[model samples]
Structure formats: C-alpha cells, structure tokens
Target: MVPKRKNSLGGGGAIPASAIVLGGGEGRRMGGNKLFLAVDGLLLLHCVLDRICPWFREVLLAVGPKDASSLSLLLEGRSWASPVRVVVDRAPGKGPLAGLVAGLREMDSPWAFLMGCDMPWIQEPLVRRMWALREREEGVLCWEREGYLEPLHAFYSRSCLPFAEEALARKDHKLKSFYPQVPVQVVPEEAFADLPGHRRSFEGINTPLQLERFRESR
Candidate 1:
C-alpha cells in the first residue's frame, strides 16, 4: 500500500515545495572548500540541484557571497532550463540554522526541501518520499542511526518561518532546540529505506576522504 501523504502540497501535478540547497557551510573538515568538490564527475552542488530540480516548483540555492561568482559561472546559461536562483546568506558562518532561516524567509512557495550541498549520494526518490509525508508538523527530518536529527536534509513548512526566525534572533542555532516549540515528524530509517538507493544518503560529506568514498562508490 502507498504511504499516506500529508499537506499534499504543490497541487495535483507538481509538488508545491521549492528547494533550498544550503551551500553555505565552511567545509573546514574537508580542508577549505567542499561545494566545489567533484563527485561522480559532477560538482557536489550541481549533483544536489540536479536531484531536486524535477521535484519542486523552483530551486533556490543559499550560498555564500565568497563563492557566489564561481557558483554562478557553474550555472550560467543553464538557468534557462530551470527556475534556479542563487541567494546569498546575510549572516555568514552562523551555521545551518541561519541558512534555514534565509531559505524560509526567501521562499515564495509553501514548503522548502532543505539539503546540504555536500551530500552527493542523496537520492531524489528519498526527497520525494519526505515531501509526500510532510504533515502539519513543522519538519519531516531524518532520524540518524545515532538517534539525532539530520537537520540539513529535511522538509520544513513555510509556517515554521516565524519560529525559525525567532530562534536565529535569540542565537539559538540548534535545530533540535526548536522541536518542542513546533510539530515535527522523524522519518525513520525503515521509512527512508522504502525509497530506492542507499539508505545512508543522509551521511554528510565532511572530508576529502568521504568525497573519495563517494567517487569509489559511483
């Protein structure tokens, strides 16, 4: 049987979800830059955008101004093919919470699928599954094996904007800290496995070694 879908966004045809590829991380563990890392012959950022572009109405990338020019050069004329927009973070080096706030505030759609740019292994099918299951809950986030939320790769509603903004204002950057204040659903590993591809896609790429692993796997 098909799993129940919540919110049912994007209308009957396209999912109302707009994607926010959070590419503002410092990538310190990867020795400086990571979004530029090559994975399976594709830039990690492009691999992420390519995966989610088909599932959402618009794709907005939240990147840093320092790397904005290079990122723009990567997309150039390709903007004609998709509704891709590159937005820079106002408060840099703050963390993923800041990026999420920027994404939600800049969103023109009802829901936003937020993911880190370093995750080249994340499959589109898993993203679609999370979107389909998004409920009245503020977020449909990942339940990592270590029993923590994978805040980056998740589905957050537009309604969570206010709370998220407040969290940032209070310097409460931890995504888990706001969970008690709003509704949230954890997409367990079993449920995530229903979608095709490796179940460990939520595993983030932090070092060059991890990037090499992704290359080897491909």
Candidate 2:
C-alpha cells in the first residue's frame, strides 16, 4: 500500500519517489488480464513488484476500474518488504495514456518510474544501473537490439506533464508521442551487461504462449 502521505515544512526534507505499475491493459492479445498470470510460483504483478520494491520507496498499481476491486483485495491484507498502493484510472478505456495521466497526477515524487506489469524479469541491479545513468532529460528508456526502445520501462520527470497531457488531448495515446516533445535518453542493452541477468529484463508477457516459453526457458 502507498505509505500514508506526509507533509513537511522543509522543502529539502525528502522527495517522495515511487513506481507506477501499469496493469490496466485490456490484454486483447493475451485473451485476458496478463497481470494475474503465474510465473515462478507468484502472480506476474507480484513478481514485478518484488523487483521494483527495492528501488522505489513506494509502489502503486494502476488498474482499470473493472480490475480495481479485485486488485485492491490482493494488495490489502498482504505484507510487503516495501510500501505499495492501488490506484484506479480516472478515465477508463483510454488505454495506457489515460492510466499514465492518472498516475502522474497522483504520484508524490518528482520522478516516477513507469513500468509494464508483464516484464517479470526486471532486476534490481538493472533498475539501480539505469537510475545512475539517467539524465535530467524528461524521459529515459531502455534500448535493446538495433532500434528498440522499451518505453514502458522508463523514467519520467513531472516536467513532461504538459507534453503527456497534450498528447492525450489529441487522442494520440502512444507513449512515444511524448518523446519528441521531451528530451529522451535511450540506454543501450550493452550498458546493462555488467548487471547479471540483464538480458531478460525486456521480455514482456503479452500472450500465454510467451509465458509458457519463458517458463520452459527458466
């Protein structure tokens, strides 16, 4: 659960940082919600959180209205090594664009890490490595292969809020829409080689078949 909000007079006291887990997708390709899929004995969402908790002071699961009730129960009455929160999308059916707007609005931190729930292989070392490499630029995403930028696993500065809002207003829901408007730094896959098991961090679970393949490979 998101730690209780805090208010302090000292402006430099501390910055409230957090991670927003995007679990609001319709999962049309997967035929159902992929966040609940089992991976290595735990739900996919949990696996992602397990990796994220070490890096973020707080975690929020941004789910669609339809999934909030059930997801809330799962988040509640459970103890985690780190704090977590479940927030619902204010505007449903608008895809991740809406979810992101809602998440950025609710986030307490100046910098929030946006993550897709399907990437179960994200490692803590990779997160730490990326943060160290991040620039003041508005966006920083993972780059793999020749020209693949994993926008979902990225860092966003609240400074880009207006750009994101403008994109949503134009009905341009894709995450990359904000790239041109904001300075983005793409970290190549090679940069993460020092981090053990880094190659698997970009593996996203979009379909049941992919999950099976991941299981077998594991």
Candidate 3:
C-alpha cells in the first residue's frame, strides 16, 4: 500500500505530489553504476529515496534498461514510506530529459519533484521550502544559484508535459530546454540562506574523485 502524503510544511494534511528520482545515467565518469555506490552505509540511490519518499504520495525511479536487475536487488526486502515505481526511459541515451519525461508520464499527481539519484545531500527542509513556494504554480519551480537554474533539483507540473514532449521530438535533450516555453519560477538563493546546508543541498556526486571527497568529508 502507498503511504499517505503529508504537507511538508507540517500542516497535518495530505499533499498531492510525487517524487521522481532520475537514475538512468550511464555513469561513465564514475566507472560503473554510481547509484549503487555505498555512502554512509546506504547506497547513494537509497539515501536519496529515504530522504524524499515521505513527502510524496508516490515515488518513481527512472532507470536505464540495464539497471532493472541491480535496482531490484537494491530495493528487495525493503519497505518505503511511499509506493515506489520503476520507470525505464522510453528512448535510451536521450539524457535526463528522457528520464524526466518517462517519470512525468507515470505521475498521477498534479505536481512532482524531480531529483537526481546522485544528489545524496538533498535536505528535506529546503525541499519543503521549495514546495511551499510552488503553491498552485502552473509550471516549473526551481532554484537559481549563481544565475543558473537548478533544473534537476526542482518541481515540475504535469502541465509541462507538452513542452517536454516538444523538446524530445526536436531532439533537444537539454533538461532546461523547455523552460522558456513554460512558466518558470526561479527561487533566489537568498530564500534558502537560513536553511542548514543550503549551499550544498544540490550537490551531486559525479566522478570517482568527487565521491571519494564526499565520503572523506562525511
């Protein structure tokens, strides 16, 4: 059974939202499956799921064709706070945009939060703040740091489906390529200035060196 969604703002009510974790990357830089890499006694993917699953009614993991078996093993015998669904990219090698499209297509909620599987440092407080700011917004809601939008760590509405589809059809796989065609709310960095670890909330482990440094720091 899927767990009940709660308002991230502590309102004691159900919130209509889903969490989408993009895990279809080739991980060439990490030399292999980076999602399975162990960090703080938990796999990088699991660590991310554990932190964000409770905030949504359902959680969808977008994986590549070759990731099914490994991901199944990682999730076996484990229980989650929400129903977890695994979605494979419709078109392989199309990048994060493909994963996002696959995830949004399966989402039943009006809004979904998109997160990269490698972002193990994502903070719930910062996410809650973002969700709070997304109230009834009709398009994408993301944070901007140093003038660049954090598309992977953002909220996307089902209304973005058309734009996403258009981008894919045009062979433009950039995750933020459709932003200009939709209503986007870019949350300034100062909004999260008071949150703990706000500066590193969107940090992701990409290469082996970065992973090693992350593990050492932790």
Best by lDDT: 3
Candidate 1 colliding pairs: 10-15, 10-16
For model 2, residues 79-167, the per-residue Cα lDDT tens digits are: 66667888888767777777777778878777778888888777666665666665564554445445678777777777777888899
* lDDT of each residue in 1-218, candidate 1, tens digit only: 23465533323444677778888877788876676877666777776676667667887878777877888888876643248888887777778777777888888887887878777777656666666665564544444545667777777888787888888788888866577777787756566554556466677788777888878876
In candidate 1, stretches whose alpha carbon ends up further than 4 angstroms from where it belongs are 1-14, 39-41, 79-81, 137-146, 196-198
- What 10-residue stretch in candidate 2 is worst by lDDT? 1-10
TM-score of each: 0.83, 0.82, 0.88
Name the regions of candidate 3 deviating beyond 4 angstroms: 1-15, 216-218
Per TM-score, what order, best first?
A: 3, 1, 2
Give lDDT for model 1. Answer: 0.72
Model 1, residue 158: what's the lDDT?
83
Per residue, candidate 3 scores C-alpha lDDT tens digits across 1-218 of 11122443434223478888988887888877676788778787776777777778898998888886779877988888888888888887899899899988999898988988888788777787777666455899898888899998899999998899899999999999999999998778777777778878889898878887877876
Candidate 3 global TM-score: 0.88
Give the better candidate number (2 or 3) by lDDT.
3
lDDT of each: 0.72, 0.72, 0.82
Q: Please name the candidate that would achieve the greatest TM-score relative to the true structure.
A: 3
Candidate 2 residue spans exceeding 4 A from truth: 1-16, 39-41, 137-145, 213-218
